[model samples]
Target chain A: MKKLINAVEDVVVDSLRGVAAAHPDSLKVDLDHRIVLRASGPVDGKVGLVSGGGSGHEPLHSGYVGRGMLDAACCGEVFTSPVPDQITEATKAVDGGAGVLHIVKNYTGDVMNFDMAAEMASMEAGTRVESVVIADDVAVQDSLYTAGRRGVGLTVLAEKILGAAAEEKRDLDALLALAQRINEGGRSFGVALTSCTVPAAGKPTFDLSDNEMELGVGIHGEPGRETTTLGTAADVASQIVEPILADRDFTASPVIAMLNGMGGTPLIEQYLVWGEIAKILAGKGVTVARTLVGNHITSLEMAGCSLTLLSADDDLLTLWDAPVETPGLRWGC
Target chain B: MKKLINAVEDVVVDSLRGVAAAHPDSLKVDLDHRIVLRASGPVDGKVGLVSGGGSGHEPLHSGYVGRGMLDAACCGEVFTSPVPDQITEATKAVDGGAGVLHIVKNYTGDVMNFDMAAEMASMEAGTRVESVVIADDVAVQDSLYTAGRRGVGLTVLAEKILGAAAEEKRDLDALLALAQRINEGGRSFGVALTSCTVPAAGKPTFDLSDNEMELGVGIHGEPGRETTTLGTAADVASQIVEPILADRDFTASPVIAMLNGMGGTPLIEQYLVWGEIAKILAGKGVTVARTLVGNHITSLEMAGCSLTLLSADDDLLTLWDAPVETPGLRWGC
Candidate 1:
């Protein structure tokens, strides 16, 4: 409730204004449509990459809008899916001579709206738009807002890899195949020590006792696999990593590991958790080729952490290492 | 207190293990001495940069140890200054043929301990060492841990600018003078909505009423200027910016502004605050040539933010734009 915001209704637009103001050289904001576009986007013959979802998980869809990442991001209200209109506008804005690719998370509202937007873009402008839904959270098969597994931490990885591929001027079909490959290979699990409060709600989304944690919690505070007793970082790491490895066998290929923070947890704790997880992976003989530890996809001020493991080949690793200059993720540029 | 930690005693070392694991290509960790060193360090004739302090303000000293930044960072227990021995070892480990420079915050323990380390390095190893102490916080003339002003957000900026300068093969004396100039040109102010709990303490460092906030708070939860009623981001922005601009004349030149989060605040809220701060700066005719908004320097999981503005000329701006490959900050590599 003590958030640094003016009014609840103005939160998304205001934050976008700040984003535009902060990255004037790289990002261009269309406030009226609530879409953030790359300042130098729509490469003449390259497929445009667009992704979006609810607002609270920052540095995700919007913060990733720049060269080598996302061409445009259609921002919705906090924890609410962007309307089809917004997504359509984002699609049209980033459409070059090549087709557009929509990288969407697996939420019912988001999936449906993005589909509608794709149809609208195709019908209105004859623009070919391909949609790739990311449902990599190994938490639950269904959640409060998602019919399938909720797209969690893997979305960030997918965006980075797909963005790099798009920057290489890969056709829409190839990008779609890569996106599906990433979705198939990536798995994520999250634990919430505390629930986040939406600005409009002005109260925590859920109640979690100090000694308890939500195992496999969704990004929007949806019910997880179980409400379990809170344990040490080692215990938490086992709980998170076991389910992820059980769901996907990472031993077959070199893995890219991401130990992501859920807003409220500090970097030191993230590193601590990563250390424990690394030990577990090493014991299991998982070869981690790349590791990222920070708050990439966060649930607004929720104290917890998530783990994402992607089975990566040399190609995926190369794409990940490619220069990316987004506000949220940057490297090798 | 809820934190993702193993044990109170192992927090620093365990976290360092994670850091070393996550950034094997860029960083090397010495667990016995609790020092994070650049994997490729002691560049033949470049002045080595060494900075260290307490452990809690992460990504401050430890995360900054990489190429184009600090050659070494000494890690102490949470909220406790690094021992002279640890600092001396770090100094020795990173001492190139040219010399070494120590960037110390203005905390009494940090300044004193770094000074002792410098003396030890000079007397015992015959290594030349120079020190630059940052006292940029305009919050208070003195605080619980500092003799003069508390070094807050400006340390990040100073380390960055000095790191770039050192990479250009600047000598120890020239880096020291540049550091002092940066310290004089920079000012910082912070606000805390809630207090953070040290792992050993198992409780909050300080308390504020639910409806109140600590204005001008230090990174260690020390008392601030006043406990004021919670206000909107606009109101808070005015309170933060007015004091900073009043204390210095940022209008004389372009400014590099950073709106930094204190761990627990969400990026959305930080951007919202930055939006408000940007409006105020524009109204005041302060030209911001560059801006950074995120959690760079943090106080554990304290829910608040701080702002640092450095007056910049063409030279400083160029250095600020230099490539930095730290875990906490990165661009243009």
Candidate 2:
């Protein structure tokens, strides 16, 4: 594998160190606990948003930490869940007088560990922590790294919208409701042009011919539900968007959509994909209110793209447009 | 060789269509001329900022066409400089009565085209257009795509800061002075871990072994000064920054630094590389007043990073901190 890393074992820590050095003003990295916390954390009377999963889907949990986003993000090893201790520490660290919310993606290990951490926080620190599981990926019902639907691009939308609400001092119950609303309202579908190499594995997670693509691929290089010959951006976009619209009725509200690049796809292709997705969505009588197109949630060096559509009411749209200052997604700050 | 495109020849136009569709609110595309013009273009009496190059280095030109960044950007085919006709149309479109500034990268074709466009604008539209060629890459004395130094990451910096200056009603001459100052003060060096494939070429631009890297590689996959074994991020960072400091004396003032990822490198790795670069700069007593870390000036899907440093005065820093609202770089909008 041709990765710019020191050693396989050192990948996560080394990367975390870099994260710390880059955004010294906005974030503070707890080197020992492996949690990225808001530099000025535990803001009194503000609900603390905490979310994390595997490390490879970058700018996801970590990059979402700052004003109007997560108060802390527990960084796990690549494609691996953070240990309960790490999650527990993060829960305590970000807790203000207002309680904490743990945004766990719907992966078996992540769910289990976050659940344990929430319970531990409640019992030991008496910090009321609520956990919401995100399962937005409409790929496989179950996958190699997940028990049910994988939490994919919706995590980004959820973080941005919910982070805004949290900044407004939304209570834990209200924030939890918003989280559930986002999870239920959003759906995601992904396609992979190439498999990403996990540093430890030192090889592509999977292989495909030049003409093939893995439809419905997961962020961790998990085997997609279907494999097929690659097609034009418009054709590929139709396939991905069809699965999403079939799974839900998004016409009830204007949707906030994201055409996120899996790490290696160039922006040009992503935009082209977005153009086709927009045309398709327009034809379906669906109006997209807010659009985010980039590699916001990405697998490490995986060549593919994912689409997330979240049915938005005025409230969610307002929250999404709210100022957010973070490493990954920053605007109006 | 794999890419998500329709016909190879349709890449640029299809991608521009995507761009025009995606950012309709902030930008309007001249479909015929292949220019990305600000939706509200050429404010009367305001200095117009125009830039462009080959299509692959995204967010460099098109993504930057918005309020406080660029008035317009001419789009070219993949890895090809825009023809003089396209540049000439863009010049006349964004003339704004005050004048137009042509920000051209130092590639031979780009320089030739922009020069010809400037003369055409003067003759046909009576628009005073001044061109500032950015040749910041300190990798090679000459390159395959360029006669002298290839413009790399510094073009982004110049556009951002100079755009702000122009937005504040800095006249053509002052903006030109600022641009020249920035071009002289800035330097960039890039390294490529893997070559990017131009969809039209249907293959990688160059080749590297699993353990090898191209040091000081140009944005368009031109050969660097050296090819060596892949090293740790710190070692790589040291290699990149050393030659830059040796080329000029940046100790007299605080520098603005950007650790830019060539499209394919993951954000985590980019931050890690930034961590190493920041440390080395600190050790060398070079105070970095501002830092930007991301794939702002990408080379298609090339897996690597580049470093750009510009000596910043208070005026430049103030302009740098000014609000910019663009698809690629947006802040304080």
Candidate 3:
């Protein structure tokens, strides 16, 4: 693997060091705990938002740590869940007087580890913690690392919306209800033209023929619905959007659409696919209120794209439009 | 190639359709001319900014067409310069009462075409136009596409700083001077681990063995200084930074650094490489005032990165901190 990295074991810490060096005004990093915290965080009487997962999907957890997004992100090794100790430290570091909310993806390891950390934080430090597991990927009911459905691109949306709500000082209960509502309203599906190589593995996670693609691959190269021959951008857009639209009826409310790149795809192709998807959505009478087109959540350098649609109302749209200052997603700030 | 495209000839137009569909609120697309214009442009007496080049280096010209940025971007075919007609149309479309400024990169075709467009706009439409050609790449004295130097990553920084100045109602003369100052103060260098495939080419632009890399490579896979064996991130960081520091002294003033991805490299590795770069800069006493770490200007899906450092004074730093809302870069909207 010709990656721009030093030793494989130092990847996560070294990246965190870069994050710390890059965003000294906005982000604070704890190299010992592998947690990234907001530089000006733990506001008194404000709800603290925390989320984390594996490392490869960047600008997701750690990159989202800032004023209007996440208060802290507990980063794990590449494609590996952060230990319970790391999560506990992150929760404690961000807990204000109000409470802490853990925004987690629906991986079995992540779910269990976050749960254990929540218990530890509450029992040891009297910090009230709530967890919301995002399982918005409609690609598969079960995956290699997940039980029900994998949490894919929707985690980025959930973090933004919830972060805005938390910034509004919503109590932990209200934030919990909003998180569940977001999880219900969102659906995602991905396709991988190539597999990503982990730093430790030093080889591609899986093999894909040049003419073939994984139709509904998970973020970590998990087996998808099927492997199919490559098609045109229009066909790929339909294949991605059809499953998402079928999984949920988005015609009722205005939807927030995200045409996210799976790390390796360029923005030109992302926009092209987004154009086709927009046409399909408009034809199907779905009103898209807002759209985000870029790489928000990714699986290392996997060359594919994913579509996530959230059936949004005016309130959710307002929250999304509110000022956010994270490195991954920022606007109106 | 396994690109998400409809056809080889339609890549530029189709991608523009997606861009138009994605950012309707902020951008307007002239499908016939293949120009992306700001939706709220021609601001009475504000000096207009127009920039364009080839299509493959995305988010370079087109994606920067929004508030506090370029007023128009002419989209050429992949790796091909925009014709004089397209540039002239874009110039006329964005020419306010004050004047219009053309930000042209140093590529031979681009420089020539933009010059022709400036003359056409001045002669045919009686619109005043001024041009500033940027050649900031220190990789080589000349390349296949450029006369003096390849305008690699510095175009992004120049557009942003100049865009902010234009928003402040700087006239064409002042904007031209500022653009020249920015071009003089900035230096860029790139490395490519693998090559990218153009849609029309249907194959990789260049080849490199698994353990080899092209150091000081041009943005369009132009031959670099040499093909060297791959090194660790620390060694690669030194290899990139040494030549830049040798060419210019960044320690005298604050620097705005951008560690940009060459499209296909993932953020994890980019940050890891950035960590080492930060160490080198700090050790060398280069005070970085602002840092941008992600894909800004890209060369399709080439797997590598480039570093851009713009030595800035107080005025330029203030301009750099101004609000910019574009599909490629958005902050403090």
lDDT per residue, candidate 3, A176-209, as tens digits? 9999999999999999999999989989999999
Where does model 1 exceed 4 Å of error? none
For all the predictions, what are the DockQ values?
A: 0.86, 0.74, 0.88
Q: State each model's C-alpha RMSD to the native.
A: 0.7, 1.1, 0.7
Better of 2 and 3 by lDDT: 3
The interface root mean square deviation of candidate 2 comes to 1.1
TM-score of candidate 1 on Cα atoms, chains taken together:
0.99
lDDT of 3: 0.92
Q: Write the per-residue lDDT of candidate 1 for residues A1-333, one digit (tens) a residue.
A: 878898899999999989988999999999999999998868898998889989999988899998788999999999999999999998988999799999999999999999999999999888999999999999899889988889989999999999999999999999999998999999999999999999999899999998999999999999899999998999999999999989888999999999999999999999999999999999999999999999999999999999999999999999999999989999999
User: Which residue runs does candidate 3 get wrong by more than 4 Å?
Assistant: none
* Per-residue lDDT of candidate 3, residues B157-263 (tens digit): 99999999988998888988999899999999989999999899999999999999999999889999999999999999999998899999999998999999999
Lowest summed lDDT window (length 10), candidate 3 chain B: B142-151
Question: Tens digit of lDDT per residue, candidate 2, span B1-333?
Answer: 678777888888888888877887888988888899999878988889999999998877899988889999998998899999999999999988999999999999999999999999999999999989999999898778788889989999999998999999989999988998999999999999999999988889999998999999999999998999999888899999998999998899999999999999998898888888888898999999888988899999999999999999999999999999899998876
What are the TM-scores, per candidate, against the unseen true structure? 0.99, 0.99, 0.99
Say which candidate scores most in DockQ. Answer: 3
Worst lDDT 10-window in candidate 1 chain A = A39-48
Indicate whether candidate 1 or candidate 3 has the larger DockQ: 3
Q: What's the lDDT for all of these models?
A: 0.93, 0.91, 0.92
